[model samples]
Target: MSTPNPNPENRQINIIDPAFTLNPQPVYDEVLTRYRVAKTIGLNSPVISRYEDVIWALRHPEIFSSEMDMHVGLGTERPMIPQQLDPPLQTRYRKILDLQFSRARVMEIEPDVRRHANELIDQFVDAGECEFDRDFAIPLPCRAFLRMMGLPQEDLELFLELKNGIIRPPIANPYDIAAAKEYRAKTGKRIYAYFEALIDDREKSPRDDMMTYFTKVELDGKKLTRNEILDICFLFLLGGLDTVTATLGCSVFYLAENPEHRRRLAEDPSLVPAAVEELLRWQTPVTIVPRILKQDWELDGVQMKAGSMVSLLIGAANVDEQEFGAGEGKCVHFERERNRHIAFGAGPHRCLGSHLARMELRVGLEEWHRRIPSYSIKAGETPRVSPGIREVMYLPLVWEKGGAA
Candidate 1:
């Protein structure tokens, strides 16, 4: 459990460090095998990367509290509800949220999801080339979220900008911890302000949307406060826009490179569901999950003190050799059996929109391949990958015009 000098080489690694962002598997490979738990640079928290350890930590949220102060250090003014709350409170908010994103409810929009995916592909399928991220990956998910939230489609660009500002801002230097924190604070305030206006608007002119539901939704016989609603709105806005986009981009990038796999999925549409899980495990967009220690504890011999910050490395854990089998972690196998991936996370705080995410991912892949079956990474172009929230940016794809359709 405890290994003195786990990282004897002292190879500098931080979740946000460029080296870590560009390719994190190497770092994870080293740390996960060397020590189930270890510390890293740039991130003031200890890193837990082993599959079992990460699962243990997530399942036991009481000890490893999710009450992370994500308020940009500007205090309670911009609290991210449910995500930053614990137990009873977190449970209450999640109850209300569960109803809206329930599997049955999300399925009701499957037709629209399919329609939107085709609509976006319609723009570039005939051209024989397109930037997958911009033309397809990005817009499809955002449009679905807008349709679900009943938000104006025109505001997609604005909301996308705001989401990036908080999660992955256009930083001059991503490793600059101080600067990134400051930028997020400013962006978070803008998000808070934006939601406040929406909440106020719905209060006067109620509509049939999630925003209105939050305004009237009650917990323990009391309506959710303005702050609580803002927190929910804030969390939903980010989750709706980013998570699926990240997954779609990663999956498409893989498909572009692996035509064999693409052909199989396109030929056998039923395989798409199984393929989705493997892709999520392989290209986990969410890399770091942060939690604050409630009390001193020793996990697998690693001593962590109370109040310390511990990061459950989901991206690393998903590929852990111990869980996924030796050498298999690196291989993208669509027919992988017993593939228990924590891409959407685990335990009490598992992604509320997971149903919607799975639908969007499946529909996006199914519809695209149904339209354009054969494609590959454009010649001389390589996708740009990031570290912390592992992603494939600007995936340029090309195919023979009318050849595979």
Candidate 2:
């Protein structure tokens, strides 16, 4: 996946760069091949790259704390529940959350996910050309989220506006940090107010939905506080809607360039699950996760301060030859056995929605291949990927009219 870098020591990687988001495997390769702990160019944070080292950091939350004051600008009034906390409080929250997002519960939503995929395809499958991100990548997950949260489908536009306001902030200048923060703070208030109303509505008339469950579910013999429920919903609103969309976009983008791999799935649909996992590892949409050190500790000969931020390069760790193998073309093998990639993180705080995410990715690819099986990137247009999540914000795709071969 990467040409060998003779001078990996001098390699300058900016995780927020379009180049990195477009193709991060080379940077991962270089980091794994040369340095155990590295640093990024633009962000200038210490990076932990090896698979073993990363797993250690993820597992030992006491040494590497997730609790921090980093997300105020992202519209989080408080730490978004569970994700931003460590055990045993985080563990208790997961006990309540796990049931809501279990594999069996997630499977209940599959039919709707499949139906939505086909409906999205129907809109553009006959046109022979479509902007994949706008047409399919964005809405599918948003609709699924609306269903899961028991929100009205017609509010998709407003939801998108709120999400975009917090994420990209809709500022005229991308570098205007002050304006972006101010805009997100305003959006944060809206998110809280909206969810607060939903919590109230659920209290008045409970339904068989996540919001209702949160309203009634007892934790340690008492129902959750309103702030706790609001915090949890806030996490779900941001995480549930964005992650699958980004992963789906990156996966389809991969298949577009690698027609051979795409043909494999089209010819045999059963490979979709494995293909999804492989893409999760290869693409690693949520590129880097940050942790603030709880105490002064040295890792892999790198000295660290107590409050310094450690950027765990799970993206690089996923491709590390130490774990995934070093044989030619084997590190990124789609069908590789014994793959324990941590694209979803590891240990106690592993993604709670992984089951739902897998189901969505699998159904999405299966349906897309079933209908638009032979699409490619539109000529004279390059995919535009965002910096943080590696989302293909502008992915123009084209195929022969009515083509399914």
Candidate 1, backbone clash total: 4
Candidate 2 C-alpha lDDT tens digits along 133-250: 8899899988887877778889898898888888888889989999999999999999999989999999999999988999999999999999999889888878887788899999
Model 2, 373: alpha-carbon shift in Å? Answer: 1.0
Can you give the TM-score per candidate against the true fold?
Answer: 0.91, 0.96
* Predicted structure with the largest TM-score when compared to the true one: 2
Once superposed on the true structure, which residue ranges of model 2 sit more than 4 Å away at CA?
1-12, 328-331
Clashing residue pairs in all predictions, respectively, total: 4, 0
* lDDT (10s digit) by residue, model 1, range 1-405: 325544322433467666666567788787776766777676666788888989989988899998766565431365577888888778888888899999888898889989988888878888899998888888888889988887888988998888888777778996687887788778888888888898999999999988899898889899989888877778787667677888898888878778899899989999999999999998788987889999997765557889889888898899988889888987889889889999989999898899999999999999988888889988998688766566567788888987645
Model 2, residue pairs in steric clash: none
RMSD of each: 2.6, 2.7
What are the lDDT scores of the predictions, listed in order?
Answer: 0.82, 0.85
